[model samples]
Target: MLKKTLLAAGTAAALSFAGAAQADIIDLFTTDQNALILTDVGGPIFSQVSGANILGGFRDIGLQVFSDTGSPAARAIVEVSGGVFTFSNDNGIGGQATIQWDGGTDALDPGVLNTTGLGGVDLLAASADRFILDVLTADLGFPFQLRATDMLGGDFTISLTSAGPGTFEIPFAAFVGVDFSQIGSLSAVINTAGDTLALDLSVASIVTNQVPEPAVLSLLGLGLLGFGITSLRKTKTA
Candidate 1:
């Protein structure tokens, strides 16, 4: 009777934990699966690049760079390729994006989702516990904001302090008035801050993190306890 009870408990725990683990992660985007490349040319008043990520329902990945002086003859190059977003000012000689300057030079990379991409529109945000972004930057020139918006126009913005490299995890509760079931997009903006002549930003991946509920945790613990008792009983009997 003792052996049977222990075996049953362990089996039940394992099954429960396995089921919860299946829903623990949802991939948003990864370069190994999709790639977006963009670049700017000299003498263009407005230069931009945009494309689909081809993963999680073909979400859009785009970037835009323009002259601060509104000149059709300025030379500044900004590009994103091989997962790295590079902004170069040509050693301060070129009129590159001065993010906070009145000249209006800046960069915008709007990572817009397909809404109905990740498992459908209803479950996209509802199923996700939090959003995660994996990035590496070389002291970003200015403060940047990661903004998320829902289909209903409700939005939330997360500020990212200047850092070299790190992972950002945003909880769903942080968003105000945003409908989780109707998530629309995520965008990054660096519009109102001092600019650095040269900057490199690399994005590794983006994903969601989901954790098992309390009941699942309890089940896991019970399973471990049962296994320990069973082992002890067998050793003593032998």
Candidate 2:
């Protein structure tokens, strides 16, 4: 009887382990005005990037000015107006902004999802399997780059060209050898010559996959312990 109980527990645990795969959805934009803004030590959602360092700034990120409230809450919609890039801080100088998705080390924070510890390869593979971007605009400029950076400072960039704008599935497979475990942030940068470029772009949604919690491991361990206890009882009875 005890042996049977042990075998049943082991089988149940194995089934649980197999079913551990799950999906986590993160919304970049919401109708809630009080939504938690993505930020890091650099600043709020928008910041100025110079020489690998992000500085605090409002308009520097170029996102605050281009937002579409008319869009549905299912995704964030942004439209870029005309902006000139200047070197003297008079206009804007090749703007780039980073939005941190995994809230760093703050357990109590609302944005905390605790994904930095996941294995890089696992994260990237999972994301690649389930990643989608819905773009609602017709023009997103020419030669814009979308970048994802890991905690180890490894960056994978994808150069995007305007295809008359529609739902775009991000080529997560392009991020080969990236440390997905520490996927710290996502950024967008526009490359233009002569420090002046006309801008028109819009993004509707960004959806990606993430690993499930480690709770299943604990449950498996418990199941194993129970199985061991049952086996010991069977040995004593015999």
Candidate 3:
């Protein structure tokens, strides 16, 4: 019954907010340790910190597709739930992960932080996860591409299926800083166990800065509905 209500609410919200330019993910990364994190752009602001780690296992082989717009068939957005953009990504031979965002306001934080280090990370020399980030655009509605962000700007695409079936990356962490101009402070963690991986955020520790549009609209609609319904009832009784 609750699920039904939420679905109806979401649909109604989508309708009222038609032409409100929805947000989509810009990138998703799944490691050999089987860990995944989705980065998105141009939508509503959303963020969560981990009170615990979310775990899951996946296959060793999959797809790598891209879309030009919001379509996964044309380019890559986010979310790595087994047959999305990176369908064969489970054990892809060569692939890349690209991410960037800026909702109407700041949405989810791109930074993933760690106090107790995660395993299998290709880390930086500072004892923290030092990722090589390159800004590709200021446009928030287009598809972002992931490539070999090497010194030579070489074309060394990553293949998840590198060596042994269980072989994976190293131990390290990633800190994706969201734009400070909008909303700020989103820390995350990525871990791996065998063929699967996990994402842990510092949710219970930080302040939630953004609210999804659907929730806000629902509250407003309910207020209006109650006012109308009460007026009708009062007139009937009178």
**Which candidate comes out best when scored by TM-score?**
1
Ranked by lDDT, top first:
1, 2, 3
Report residue 124 deviation for candidate 3 (angstroms): 16
lDDT of 3 at 182: 20
- Tell me the TM-score of each prediction against the true structure: 0.48, 0.41, 0.19
Stretches > 4 Å off in candidate 2: 1-23, 31-130, 190-198, 209-238
TM-score of 3: 0.19
Candidate 2 achieves a global lDDT of 0.32
Decoy 2 TM-score against native: 0.41
Give the per-residue lDDT digits (tens) of candidate 1, residues 85-170. Answer: 43433222222321110111122422323322233233343355555555544433334455555555555665443433455444
Clashes of 1: 0
Q: Tell me the tens digit of each residue's lDDT in model 2 across 165-238.
A: 34333434445544545565554444322122223333434556442245743554454442211110001110
Name the candidate, 1 or 2, with the larger lDDT value.
1
lDDT of every model, 2 decimals: 0.37, 0.32, 0.20
lDDT of 3 by residue, 150-222 (tens): 1111122111211111101111111122111221111211111112111111101111122225674465455
lDDT of 3 at 19: 20
Which candidate, 1 or 3, has the higher lDDT?
1
User: Could you arrange the candidates by TM-score from highest to lowest?
Assistant: 1, 2, 3
